[model samples]
Target: MYSKGWIMMELTMNWITLRVRNLEASLDFYHRILGLPVERRFESRGKQIVMLGIEGQPKLELIEGSDPPVKPECGVSVGFEVASLDKAMAELAKEGIPVARGPIAPNPSLRFFYILDPDGFEVQLAEHM
Candidate 1:
């Protein structure tokens, strides 16, 4: 049989890891408030890690550790797509999470808002027409 010259591999993002000061609070915010399911929780190298996301989707890993010196606002914002921006905003308000900026329409077909997580990380929730 002739040997294949090359094989194509599909690549996709697995997760995004965030170093958190309060693991429990972060877990509550992401899992309870944002409605991301807990995929798993485990300890590694004496550090606690919580993975949150629905099955078949990219997971968000929250690791308990000393916070780095970098300010949360100094980097790119993490974006999440929501079914309805208004409903998401209402939920955020109900949870006492103030909107940093937002509900702005980038174009006719899209709306978005920004809110800070428990650690001051900016997260954008967007809705598309």
Candidate 2:
């Protein structure tokens, strides 16, 4: 027999998985350009999954698929906070990644910009002002 009340369980984010058209290119963009370290790589159920992130942090998982979802031009976006937006933008420029939109300030305390990943996914980079 088991008594049921409120079972407290430790919960934290594990990963954010995105379906990608090209695993190698996506991996290069994230691992080389964005500088996320490769956490692990493995194949499961005929699909290849690559995980990237800093150790002990939430990861971004790239799953290989023939028909991945098309990223909308203006609806959905993923965001990341950076220490310095200037440095991030400069690094991105050096890599030939164009800013799709703003280095706009949504508010006085925050600045952000947008860029498209290899799979056409929009990524937002922000810094606290």
lDDT of 2 by residue, 12-123 (tens): 6888888888899999998899888999999988889999998998999999976655566646666788999999999999999999999899799999999998878888
- List lDDT for all candidates, in order: 0.87, 0.87
Model 1 lowest lDDT segment of ten = 2-11
Model 2 poorest 10 in a row by lDDT: 2-11
Off by over 4 Å in 2: 1-10
For candidate 2, what's the RMSD?
Answer: 4.5
Off by over 4 Å in 1: 1-9, 67-70
lDDT of 1 by residue, 59-121 (tens): 999999765624686785678999999999998899899899977997999999999888888
Model 1 per-residue lDDT at 44:
91
TM-score of 2: 0.85
**Cα TM-score per model:** 0.88, 0.85
